[model samples]
Structures are given as structure tokens and as C-alpha cells.
Target: MDNNLTDRSFWKAFWESRIGLIFNIKRDYIFGDMLGKIKAKKGYQTAIELGGFPGYYTIYLKKYENMDTTLFDYFVHQGLVNELLEVNGLKETDIDIIEADLFSYQPETQYDMVLSFGLIEHFKDTKAIIATHLPFLKDNGTLFITLPNFKSINGWVQRKFDLENYNKHYIESMNPALLASYCKELGLKDVESYYHGKFSMWLENKGTQSALAKAFVKSLWFTGKVFTKIFPFESKALSPYIVLKATK
Candidate 1:
């Protein structure tokens, strides 16, 4: 049985309201910088992002790294993806978009880089979900995975303000060390995992927030943004994400 916590309808509705919004925070820049550094070393030619619907991060790979990019997702919002691509001065033809389930789809060729941003944590079996990406990676190819650090201060805030969204993620898969260990056990080389990004208090609740709750969350987000600007730091207890990088 498929034990994925989220479904197509959930994502469809989620993207309905966010079709045109491209909110780039400091963490996004940090992640792009990380990608830039990796690109500098390997000069990857091709890349794919599993479960990448609107293809946000993959845009960075396409634009900055000059990679032939593909976004594979179970349910892709093609119109939204096109809109985002247009905003970045890229055409829909620039990215090859394949709409298919991650579990059932098979590619004819592997890629130099395989990525999944905030995808694996939705499934109950962390290792099984992660294993799905390996077959699509070429030998010596890089595998990058990132998930929200829901055991930290961000998790506490989400539980307080956005419990519905918090419950959707399998918190057991949110540990960097555990993720790195899983990569090694799966026979990946040079596996490295660590906490990523500075403090962030953003929540992704589907429900409407009370005025007081909204104010509090806004205040927290503002404070976090300021702190990110002044004293940028990443720690297991405060960072909002866990990143895993490995080679096949």
C-alpha cells in the first residue's frame, strides 16, 4: 500500500492559491549558493527533481548551472510551472516536465544530479522513500535531499499554529544524521548531512488563522528574518531544514 501522507488533491489545492507567488527568502538564496558551489565543482550536465511540481529549485539548476533540467511529479501544475518559468525569462521548452508517479515511472536514462526537496518526509518509510531516487542517478552522480527540521523551534511553532500541516510530515525522517546514515547504508559514497538555514518561523497550514495567531506568527517571522540578516547561523535546534548530499 502507498503510505504517502499527502495526495494529489492536497497539492492541487495548495497550488491553486500560490500559482503566481514566488516568495524567495534568505534560505532560498543560501540553498542556491550551495547548489552553485556544487555546480562549480562538477559542472553537471543533466539533473532531475522528483516530486518537483512547479519546479522552483530546479529553476536554479537550469538558470545558474546551465543544466538540462527535468521536473518529475505525480501531478504537475503545468500552467503554474510555465508561469514561473516565464517570470525567470525561460520558456516551457527549456524544462522537460514529466507527469508521473515517482514509484511507477521509469526513465530511459539517468542524470548527473538527482534531487528531491521536501519530498521523502511525506512517506512513512524514510529509507524506502529515499531509495527511489538511486536508480535514476548515474555512477558518481550527486543526490541531494532536503527536508524541514520539524524537531526544532520551527516544529514547535508549527505545532502551535499549524498543527494540520505539522502532522502531514513524518518527523522521524527529519534528522540529518539519520538521513546521512541511511544514505551510507544504501551504498552511497561521500554521504554528508547537516542542519541547514538560519531560523525561520514560516508555517504552511491550510486552515485560516485567528487574528492573534497570525500576528504572533508574523512577529516571529519578522524576528527570524532580522536575525538571519544579522547573526546568520545554523544549528540542529534552530535551523529550519536538514540537507543530505551524497554520491551514487
Candidate 2:
């Protein structure tokens, strides 16, 4: 939360995507659990991912979901998808890389699933988002999107950085509620969101009592000791990131 000492050089980890992708999308398949909730229909067999920076989970989707994946990005070469797929030890034919502007791109065919992480907040025109993927989503397809919430640790960082530029800071921190309504209006069947990553949000969500708050919070220190043991998924809520899964 405190950017006072976080030099720009230190922020390189956040800017350099490939490294972050490994830690963000672990081999455990967090998205796999979310996909399990989405049952494919009779003829549904494909999925598309938007803003696929570095293609971290492309291999996972092919291996686990067993569906053809089309990757759409504003800036990707003909072999970006193939390069990542091969880096992950996956075949070249398993994924399709499409380089197009998401705001107006059209898909050749429909898909059973769509993945968009941390992009909705960047764009205000929700219709543009729907137009790009709605036709591509087969009946009962899943749209799994992740974005930062005001309750995330990133918020704390932004808030600190905000001292330099107030407007940019507030924009970086957004409410998850807006996303909920966006999903509902888009004809998404089930809307569920979780607060994940970083520790400040957890502390803020689960309020404290000054009298015994120090003692209780000391016991609840956002550490792996009790977090992994008591509530792993719920612990995600205390963190700084937001992950949502819904169906169309």
C-alpha cells in the first residue's frame, strides 16, 4: 500500500508480464476449478481468450478443458501463441492466435468458453466488449474475467502512488459491484466474485476491535499458517485482486 519507498525499478516485476504470469497462474489450476463449474453443451467445443499476454494458461486449457483455443490480442504476432505453446511444451496446432483490436474484432466461429482477465475496467464501452465475444460464445458458454477491486492490495499501492496524480489513482481502484451489474446486464447466468490477493483488503474486510483487536488480529496475521488451514478460498477475499466467474 505504501509506494513511498517502492521505486519504479521495483515495479519492473509488475510490468514484466511473463514472470508475473507464472506466479499468477500457478500449475495448481485455479481456473480449472472455475471451469469445472461450467458444463459444456452438446456441440460446444471451443474457447477464446482475450488479452492473452504471454499465453500462460493456453496449455492448461488445451490439456484440461480439451477445447480449441483462439487467442485475441490487440498486439500479437502470427507466432506469439505458437511460441508460448511451444515454450510450455504444447503443440503449435492446439491454439490459434488472432491479432485484432478487441473493441471491433469478429470471430469466425462460436466458442464454449471465453477468458478475459483484468481488461473490463480498462474499457468503458461494455457493448464493445459484448460485441467482440457474444457471438463467439456458444449457448451456456462461460466467461471468466478477473480485475482489480478497490479492496485489493494494488489499491493500497495505487492510493500511495495517487499522491503524485490523484485522478489516476482513483481510476486504478474500482468497485467490484459495477462488474456484477455489468455481468447481469450482459445475460450472464451466474455471477460470483471473490476478493483475492494481498493482505490489506482482508484486514479491512474483516474489521477489528481495538480492545482485543490487536490480540485477535495478531492471531489472524495474514500468513500461511492459519490462512491455508482455516479458509484458503475465503482468504482470497482478503487479498488485493478480484477474480470472477460467470456463464452466458
Q: Candidate 2 at residue 124, lDDT? A: 45
Residue-level lDDT tens digits of model 2 in 1-248: 12222233422343343332333343566556555446344344677877765555455677666767777766654454555566566777777777666655667777777877655555545434544566677777777776556444435434443333222223432455665676777787777766655354223222223546445445545454456456555343356556766677
Candidate 1 error regions (>4 Å): 19-30, 222-232
lDDT of 1 by residue, 1-248 (tens): 28999998988887786633554323355578877777779877999999987887778788777889999998887777877887777888998988988787778879999999889999999999899999899999999988999898888898888888888899999888889889999999999999987887676652477888888878877887887789888987779899999999
- Candidate 2: which stretches are off by over 4 Å? 1-26, 36-44, 77-80, 125-131, 158-173, 197-237
TM, every model: 0.91, 0.66
Best by TM-score: 1
| Residue pairs in collision within model 2 | 152-240, 153-240, 195-236, 195-237, 196-236, 197-239, 197-240, 202-238
Q: Which candidate number would show the highest lDDT if scored against the true structure?
A: 1
Relative to the true structure, how large is the alpha-carbon lDDT of every model? 0.84, 0.56
Clashes of each: 0, 8
